[model samples]
Target: MELKQLEYFIVVCEQGSFNRAAECLYTSQPNVSKVILSLERELGRPLFERSPRGLRITPYGRTVREYARVVLRHTAIIRSMADYGWGKKFSLATYPSNMIAHLLADFYTHWQERYVVEHYEGTVEEVSGLVARGQAELGIVYVAQRQLSSFRHILSHKKLVFQPLDVKEACIYVGPHHPYYVRDSIDFSQLSSQRFIGGVHDYFAVEHHLERVSLGAISTRDLNYAMHSNSDHVIISALLHTDLCSLGLNFMHQPYSHYDIKTLRINGCEPFLTIGCIRQEGEPHSEAADWFVEQFRQLL
Candidate 1:
């Protein structure tokens, strides 16, 4: 019925006497006898034939003893593996996330050395789909407030779990060579006269906020769109060595080899996107997946 009961049974069979079995178990003879009786009653069979000479193991007793020993051995192996941090390989998905890139870099540097990490990159919806369809154990994706309703609908339809993370503020990145780089920060109106690069939506988000400020400049229409590309490397490279600037997440303001990224905050707004992690809702999964999520929560 229990590991201790099996242990007492084995000892009684080997020692042949209740007195000797109690000595081997370091307990009173009465306690040893009680445990064996309980085990025999729970099993619906007598494990030993009582005799004044000693105890004799029955055929059914041998069958249980062999299997019980095997169970204990397997349990020990499982505990050892858990104690040593032996975790299963986990597949993770994210939608072109620099946040996850930094988080993963920190994850590798900090703990759990034996885990195998598999990372996949895709569109935000695609990443969510991966977790929904059971292709990935976890996913990280970003959604602005306006898109939250629909995103939640999609996740619910797929039966996935999600928790929103910190908001990623939006900002404009400029090169060291740019004139505005000399100032500690630039005004909201400064963007109206500047040329920009990167996604049109990013520029418009900044422009919309600037319009609300109404510094007598109702039109961000004059703001030049010098370049438009989805590639961060290309935009960052051009911004670094050239006069062109790009709108980006505030966290993206990191230094490159030859230049440091400088950001200018808008006068009245902190334009931000909410990021969240998603996973299957009811699937049987590994503890390693939970551990990985904790690492992100602690660090990010």
Candidate 2:
């Protein structure tokens, strides 16, 4: 049996649906079913019982799945050992973000002497295309829940695997002197009462959702939308001297700790987004890229 076939079967068992299995496997439903059926034919037993909801693992399927894990794990080890990078250069395309930049720095500083690292920062669409076309070895991107389906649809078309590295909600950032700084969290609608400061390209992915939210804020006391620039320094400057509030990640406070910025979740509006490391499905990652992914994942 082919390696892909076994992978499909195992994933189908995990996800329970042909659709989800196909998505995780980066293939079509019928194709996934075909592979599983092929495996069943070879083994002379049904792996799953079909149903409207999804597939249920048969008793024999459980037995097959137990061994499949061992086989796939060993296969990965062999592949990594046998095809380890000799001199392959590594390229990574990622959307601009403070957390991602810091993580990349850690990896680059640790491996710079032994590996050459090429990094590209751009919009999610641009970097996804870059990695999809083989211009880069991997990609790091943040997809808000609203955009995830379309984003994954695009990646699936390009046959790229989406590996979520971290997940977090976007929080409000204000100076220490702000009245609400002492509060654990702020009501979502209360945001309308604060003057908003934002960056043209936010390192935090919250900007997209905030734009939609600000439309209905309709608060005369607080400035609805203030000027935003490409520079985070300018944005932070406004927050320090003015009553303007901006959106940011919780951990980002450390980088600007001297400025005394505080981060707070927006009640009823704090939706989480998945930050993922993407690579070409079924393709071998360069040793440098694999090492970086491992280290970054560990750091998270």
Q: Which candidate achieves the best TM-score against the true structure?
A: 2
**Tens digit per residue, CA lDDT, model 2, 38-127:** 899999988888877767899999998999999997786455333225534577887655555676777778776666666677667777
Give residue 174's lDDT in candidate 2 (0 to 100).
82
Best by lDDT: 2
Q: Least accurate stretch of 10 residues (summed lDDT) in model 1?
A: 250-259
| Backbone clash pairs in model 1 (N, Cα, C under 3 Å; residues 3+ apart or in different chains), count | 0
Candidate 2, residue 148: Cα displacement in angstroms equals 2.5
lDDT of each model, Cα atoms only?
0.69, 0.72
**TM-score (C-alpha) between model 1 and the true structure:** 0.54
Model 2, position 228: C-alpha lDDT score: 69
Give per-residue lDDT, candidate 2, residue 125.
71
